[model samples]
Target chain A: MGKVINGLDIESLSSLLDEARKNKELVQKISKWYARVRWAGTGFTFNSYVRNHSFTISEPSELGGPDKGPNAVEYVISALGACYLTGFILNATKRGVNIKNLEIALEGEIDNILVFLGISNEGHPGYRKVIAKAYVEADCDEKTLKEIWEETVRTSPVGNTLARNVEIVPQLSLIK
Target chain B: MATVVNGIKLEDFNALHEELKRNAEFVSKIHKWNARIRWAGSGFNFTSYVRNHKFTISEPSDIGGADSGPSAHELILTALGACYSTGFIYNATKRNIQIKNFEVAIEGEIDDILVFFGLSDKGHPGYKKIVVKAYVEADADEKTIKEIWEAAVKGSPVGNTLQRGVEIVPQVSLVRK
Candidate 1:
């Protein structure tokens, strides 16, 4: 029913159209919920304000961010996991599945220094490779759960971000 | 205002012991706040550690926190925003919104120099005021997405901390333990 790559049935290219349409709508909704405020000072004193209810985003560490604060690249990984988990949960709930617990773990590798230096776009350390494992506690059959999980990823936000190429044109403002 | 330690005012460092008996939490909070001292030596060498509950500083100074540490106050904001962001993501994921990403950019105000000097002022060194903006991108319509975000923020751990003045108590652990 689909293109087979290394014995794995890959999604048809036609599916990308629906994915793009849904992504466009989702991006707009996410944008409206987003906001930021400056801490008003130098690099050491720079501050920003955000509400938890808005879109999930963090500024760069060079701009007075706590090293604990997720950098732009880290945020990308977080987004994929979050989107996948959320998608799974919604689908499970709709099916009246009695899920006691759900967890998603993701490990990704990227070239941190190369991208930072702007030397090679070829290996921009942007999740060069990612592996995700989902753990679910449910009463459904394995076959049914597997199908649902696959469907969820196909429609999840983070998965789409990784599968598609996005162009980001950020505008910078100087501190007054 | 000079907070009293035991029977003496906080200004009199020696008297702080006396005031410690009367109001322990207040005294403790002060002790935690002043855990680190900055001296003009080779450069800006920090001697303090702000943990989940207390302020800590070692005699040698180079412990968990070094020159790269976020000032004692920055930790407070970090904890608030990080806590809120983490909580919001957990909740949103459980709700099944296909939320792809979560980040918190927090800004705080500490315009007063008194905070730096450790004076007893109405504003806390922790954060006079803080603003946290969260961005959540999901695969849902605008209305549904907004509702999920609202629910996540209102119920997040960090959001709760910011809404209320979380208690800050200082404690120490034995290395031998």
Candidate 2:
């Protein structure tokens, strides 16, 4: 099996690597991201971009926002869940596993938004703890799928980043 | 100058903080978040919910996505910018300074997408470094505004979180349903 498995094709990926190696311009590639927030009537929304993709993030009416979209903290969790899921789909398929369905639920404990604004410095400003439950289903047995899961989490850029003393946040589950 | 500025009442905010302080039940605020992805015929799409707010997250046309929405990295940056900006408005207004125009440009450098998907374990998966530039035009002197900006970053939830570092890989479970 090449680098491409399931929906992920590793051949093209390798080709890119080959091109980079052949060119010798630089072996490492860095991704750039940009996010902009404009003033809204009562609140604001971010019109952000990454590699040409764009979207808006906002707060709900409860937070004095238009409730047009989700907040930054929420997006943090979204990034965690989404990043893991995407990695799994691409990687698992490469290993000859087909996912029937999958779901990952994430929960976290934060100090306080008030603390974040320096309103009160009593507690930590970031998340103190996080937990995730993953349910997975695939062509392989639970053990084998879990082996892949371990790899998924182990290899996940987001997962690994968060694991370095950030907080005790869990990330994974395959649909059974 | 009182804390109330830009129509946001600081007294109200103070009251909430005091209440939480007085009542331990309000302590250790636990925020719940959910994000689900479904195949959109050609690619995957996500609808994430938090604080009763919803939004779409997708890839651009380059990655075979419908280019329907922003990627996850973009959202993270958005959160940082918005949070910092909010802090600026609150602090500036509370100090009795009127803001003319404000802008915050945030940039981050990630190792590579291949590192993220585990194609190669040769690089760091998340952002190696992030740079932020804030442009502030206010009634007060530049020095004062800069001081306020410093306070904003110091007090910013997103800024602090990113700087302090946090967990990324959430624990997983196998859903039988």
Candidate 3:
């Protein structure tokens, strides 16, 4: 049996990496992800679905919600944190480093929420800054771990998406 | 129970809005949202925490995960959709437009999955484009509803975050197990 680190099959992962390294066509493909949200018939609450998973999203009572689940802004930061962790683990494993533990704490700050509340439109409503702190326990030197982390952030899909501008096409269909 | 519109407490929302307008310091202060993620015991699975809520995150079997929950990319779209929905409902309620039904479908296209797989570094790994389709059934004119939809997309925090550039600061630390 092959060795396992952080519950990852190292032999299998290495094989997959080797295959991709040689197969240009396999690495050139694009992927599409989708999600849907529907109002849950109560106080700023929504049911969101992605693949086979679904979760409730709600605002706090201060925002007039029933506090069913985390708000959308919170979800954004959570997604970023999770994405970073994925990148870190994958890179560390690929580099032959065994990770003992990993955790990412994220904080996202919006420039001005008043724009979202429609009280003021002077400033942008989006997040102006995001800070991610990674706590890692691994079997590698600090230098190697830091390099992996830097590469992970640079190549992270979610990280890049948030750090740069993405084209958004909006379409609306009205049902009378 | 104050009168509800589009599942929102109109009276409460309006009062809060009014308060914010009058309170400059409160509006000027930056609001920070927090989330934490810890590696789960299995393959590519994580436990994500936001406030008091928590959920699982994992990849599909092909990508070395058990498919226990949605991937991080999917969560991004979910966040966008939810944010758009919230913006729409709040705007509609403010405009007194009665909504019978509302849904937001989001599709995001990654430029290349190879970048995420660490297979190739030729192209950007981020989403090249995101398409959002909003379906609304409301007791208002088409023009009005369309305007509200546009406003929602424009005002959505998550939507704007994706459409604009943001700063990301990374801090790394090695911990003793």
For residues B52-165, could you state the per-residue lDDT of candidate 1 as single tens digits?
111211111121112332332333344445444433443343344444444455555433322221222333222334566555545657666555555545443333323432
Residue-by-residue lDDT tens digits, candidate 2, B150-173: 777777666666656565445555
Across A1-176, the per-residue lDDT of candidate 3 in tens digits comes to 59886678998888777766777664543378899999886568899988789999998766678888999988888888889999888988777788888999999989989888776778789999999999998778989988999999999889999998999988899976
TM-score of each: 0.38, 0.78, 0.95
Candidate 1 — number of clashing residue pairs? Answer: 34
Please list the residue runs of candidate 3 whose C-alpha ends up more than 4 Å from where it truly belongs after superposition.
A18-30, B24-30
Q: In model 2, which runs have C-alpha deviations exceeding 4 angstroms?
A: A1-30, A41-54, A61-64, A164-176, B1-4, B7-23, B30-44, B61-66, B167-169
Of the true interface contacts, what fraction does each candidate have?
0.01, 0.41, 0.88
i-RMS for every candidate (Å) is: 22.9, 8.7, 1.4
Q: List TM-scores of chain B, every candidate.
A: 0.51, 0.81, 0.93
What lDDT score belongs to each candidate, Candidate 1 first? 0.37, 0.58, 0.86
TM-score of chain A of each: 0.63, 0.74, 0.91
Give the candidates in order of DockQ, highest first.
Answer: 3, 2, 1
User: Judged by lDDT relative to the true structure, which candidate is superior, 1 or 3?
Assistant: 3
The clash count for each model shown is 34, 33, 0
Docking class of 2: acceptable
